[model samples]
Target: MSPFDQHQPAAKPLTVLIVAYLFPPLAGGGIPRVQKLVKYLNRMGVHTIVLTVEPPPGMVEDPTLLNDIPAHTPISRVPLPRWMNAFLGLWRRRSESESGKQDGTHSVDAKLHETAQEHGQARSLNMKQGQTDQRNTVFRKGPQKLKQSVQKIVGHALNWLRARIFVPDDEVVWVRGAVRAGMRVIERYPVDLIFSSSGPLSNHLVARSLKRKTHLPWVADFRDPWTENMHRTSIRWRLALEKRMEKSVFEEADAITTVTESFAQDFKRLYPARDVHVIYNGFDPEDFMELEGSPPNAPLTFAYTGILYGKRHPRYFFQALKRLIDDGMIRPDDVRLEVAGVLDYPGRSENRDALIALGLETVVRDHGFLPHREALALLKTSHVLVVFGDQEATAGRYIPGKLFEYMAIGRPILGLLKPGEASRIIEQFALGVHADPSDVDEIEEALRHIVTLYRSGALLKDIAHCSSKDRLSANERLCANERLSADERFTSEACLALEDRLRRFRRDVQAEAFYALFQSVVGAKQR
Candidate 1:
C-alpha cells in the first residue's frame, strides 16, 4: 500500500484540537488548507475539534464552506469584545473608504505615469502639477497646515501604538479569548493532540499557551512563513521581536508543518533539530468531479480567481493581453479575461484603467469577490486560467492555493510565475504554459501559445506531451509547429502513471500525511 494510504486505527480514534484563525466561514487563501484537512482527517479515523475566532464584520464570509465540516464535530468560536468589534468595524469602514479613494487616484496617477514614461515628460508634468497645487493652496494655507500637523502627529502616534500593541499581528488580541475557549474544549473533549495553523500567527500563540498549561504534544502549522514571510513588517525592532517569538513557538511545538518544501527547508535550517514536514495545500477532487464536461467555447476566455493584492497584481498579464489585442493577433471580442475576487489593492484600480487605456475594457470581465463555488464554475467554463506570482524575486516560494484547483479543473493553465516551486510543479506535472511574470514579452508569447493550441484543438494534447525544455524554447515563431507527433504523446499506460503522480497532491493523500505525523508525534510523547 502507498505510504499516503490511511491507516485504520484498532483503538479509539485520536481526537485533535485544531486551532486555526482563518477557518470557514471566513473565506480566504488560508481556509481551504485547514478546511480540507478537517474534512479528510475526520474520514481517516481522526476526530477534529476546531478552535477559531468569530468572523469579524467586513471580512469575506462564505457559509457554504461550513458544509465541509463533518456533522457533530465540536467547534469553539471565540469572539472579540463588543467594544473591540465596534472599533474594528468603524476602522475597517474608514480604511475601505480611504483605499477606494486611493485606488481611484492611483488609476489616474498610473495613466499619467505611463504617459510620462513613454514621452519622457514626467518631470515636466510633476513640476506643472506641483506649481498648480501650490497656487491653489496659498490662500487656504494656515488652517490646512495646522490640520496637517495635527494629523501627522496623530498618525505617528497611532503607528507607534500599532507597532508595539500588535506584536506578531493584529489578531494577537484574540489570543486570550481563544486560549480560554481552547481550555474549555480540552476540558469537555477527549483531546489527544493539539494542531494549529498560522496566518494570523495568533493561532500558534494560543496553542503555545495551551501546550504550556496541559503539556500536550502540539503541532504548529505555518501556511506561510513567519518572520521570513514576503509580506512581513519591515521595521527593524518589530522584525527582531517577531523573529524571537517565531523561534520560541517553533522550539516548543513537537512538530512543525508548512505548505511548501522550500518553507520546510527554511525552517529546518533555522532549527535543525525540529521535526518539520511539508503538507502541500491541495484541491478537493470531489469538487471537480462534476466539472468534467466538454471544453469551454470560444472568446478564448482566460479567468483568474482570488484576491489580487500586494505584489500579486496582474499588470504584466493585462499588458500582455493588451498587446495581443493591439497586434490583432487576438480579436477584441473573440478573446476575454475574467477576473474574480477582491481587486481593491493599490494600483489595481489603475490597472483596470490601464486595460481601458490600452483599449481592453471590453476584452476583460471583472467579477469581484465571487463565492468559492461560483468561482470554480466560472473557471471550468473558461478556456484558460491564469495565476500571477508576485513580481518580487521571492515569488517562486509561493504556490497559490488556487493553482491546485486549476490543475484539478484540467484546463490549459497560464502560469505567470517566476522560476520557483510553483513553476516547477506546473512543468513537473506537464500542467500547462508558464512564463516569467516580470516579463511582458514572455507573458505575451506564453499567452499566444495557449491561444494557438486552443484554436488548433491541440492544447490538452500538446500540454501532456511537451517537456519543460520544449515549452521554454517555444517562441511565437515556433508556437504553431510546437505540437509533437502522435508517438510523442504519452501512452495510455504512461498517462495513468502521470495521474498517479498527481494523486500525491490530492486532499485525501495530504490528510493521510497529516494523520501519520500526528500518530508519530503522539506515539513519541507516549514513549
Candidate 2:
C-alpha cells in the first residue's frame, strides 16, 4: 500500500474540484490558505483540480506560491471577457494619470525646496524661498483643489454604480464563465466532490449552481463571512440581496468550514442543522525551516506583512511609537517598524501619508508588497511580528491569516487587535502581548513592556532556551523557573501548550481535517 493510502477513505483516493477565484500567484486575500490546502492534500493522496480566474493585468503576483502545488494537479485559469479586461485597463490608466499629476507637483516642489535649503538663503528666501513658496502654493492650491473635487465626484458615482450593479461582489462578472468552466472540469474528471472558497463570495455562487447540476457532495468554505464582512456594502438593498445569497449557500452546501471558531459558531447559530467546521488557516512548517535564527542583541525590530486597508491601519501603533519617541523611552534609530504589502485602500487615506504626518517617516521602513517568501524572510529577521485588524463590530468573527504566519515564524507577535480570536490566541499561547487597537495608552504600555523585556535580556534568553529544547517539554522547566510569579508560571505552561496546539494548526494537519470532512460528506452521499 502507498504510504498516503492510510489517509484515504478507501483503496481509491478521493478527487475534489477546488473552486477558488483567488489562488496561487495572487499575493494576498486568503489565497495562501487555499494554496496550502491544495499542497498538503495532494501529499496525502487527494487529487485536486483547481478552477481559478486568470489574474488580471497589474494584479500583484507571487509566482513563488505556485511552487508548492504538485505538478500533476490540473489547473484551469479562465480569462476574463475581453471587454471587461479593456474596461479594467482603462480604469487603471485613468488612476495612474491622476496619481502622476499629483506626484509631479510634489516632485517639483521638493526639488525647489532642496535648492533653496542647500543655498542656505531661507530668511533671505523671504526674497528667494518666498518666490518658490508662492509658486508651490499656486501649483497645489489652484489645480489640486479642482482635481480633488473632480475625483471625489467621480468616486461617488463609481461607488453608487458598484453598489447597485455588483449584486454580491465585483467578481460577479466572472461567475457565468467560471460555472461554465467548472462544468467542463466536472465532465473531464471523475470528480467526487466540489469544494469552493470565497471572499468574493462569487465562488460559492458558482459552486451552488454546480451542486444543483451535478448533485455532488459540496463543501463551501468561508475564509471570511459574506454579509457580515466589515467591508460589505452598507446599502440596505445590496445587503438584503447578499444575505439571500448567503442563505442559499448555507442551506445548500453539504458541509461548511470557516477559519475561526467564532465564525463557525455564528454560522451554526444561524443554520442550526448545517455541518459547520472550523478548519483554520495555517502555516507550512517547511517554509521556515531554511530561515536563519534572529540576530542576538540587534536593534529591536517589529515587522508586519499583508495588506492594510479599510479600518486596518496602524494608527494606534503609530500613536504609541510617537509617545515612546517623545518620552525618550526609545530612540528612532534603536527600534524599527518594518511594513510590507499594500498601504493604500485605493481612493482612501494613504498609510504612508499618515506616517509622514506623524513624523514617523524616517522611523518606519516601508517595503511595499514583497513576494510571499521574501515577506516571510523579512519577517524572520524581526524580534517581533506585528498583526493588525479592524476593531469594528465584525472583528471577533474575523482572524487575519497573518496571525498563523507569525506564529509559524516563531516570533512573539505584537497584536494590535480588538478582544477577539487573534487577541485570545496571543494571550492563551503566551505568543505575545496584545492591546486594544483603539487604545493608544494600552498600546504604549505594550510597547514599553516589550522594550523592557528586550533591554533586560530576558526576551532573548527565553527564545534561546525555547530553541534548545523540545518545546513540548519546556513547560515543566518553565513552571519551575523561580523568576516567574504564580501567574507567570501558568503563562509559561500555556506557552508550551501553544506548540501542542500549533501541531493541530500545521498545514498537513489541517489538510487531514479537510480530508476527514471530505470523507464524511462523500460517504453520506454514497449511502
TM-score for each candidate, following the candidate numbering: 0.82, 0.83
- All-Cα superposition RMSD per candidate: 10.8, 9.4
Give the alpha carbon lDDT tens digit for every residue of 1-527 in model 2.
32234445578889999998888776574687789889988877789999998987655666778999899999989888887666544443233222211111110000010111222222211332112232211111123656656756764454455457766765678899999999999999999999998766788999999999999999999887766665566677767877898899999999999989998888887889886888888777777665564643656878888656446778778888889989998876677666666444334445555666777655555455666776787787788888887767668667778887787676778988888888887776667889888889999999999999888876644443333444423223222222334455436455565456566667777888888889888989999
lDDT of 2 at 445: 94
lDDT score for residue 117 of model 2: 22
Q: lDDT tens digits, residues 1-527, model 1?
A: 65445455649889999998887787767788889999988887788999998876656666788899988788899997777666545434323322211111111000111111221212212332113222211111123555545544554444445556677765788899999999999999989999998876878899999999999999999878877776666677778888898999988999999989989888888888887888888878767544433344666777888655546677778788778777778787677666666443322244565665676656655555555777787787777789877777876888888888887766767888888899998877666889998899999899888878777876755443223332221111112122334674545445445556666677878888888888888989999
For candidate 1, list the clashing residue pairs, or say none.
107-350
Segments in model 2 whose C-alpha atoms lie over 4 Å from true places: 1-7, 89-149, 293-298, 345-350, 465-498
Q: Which ten residues in a row have the lowest lDDT in candidate 2?
A: 105-114
Local distance difference test scores for all models: 0.69, 0.69
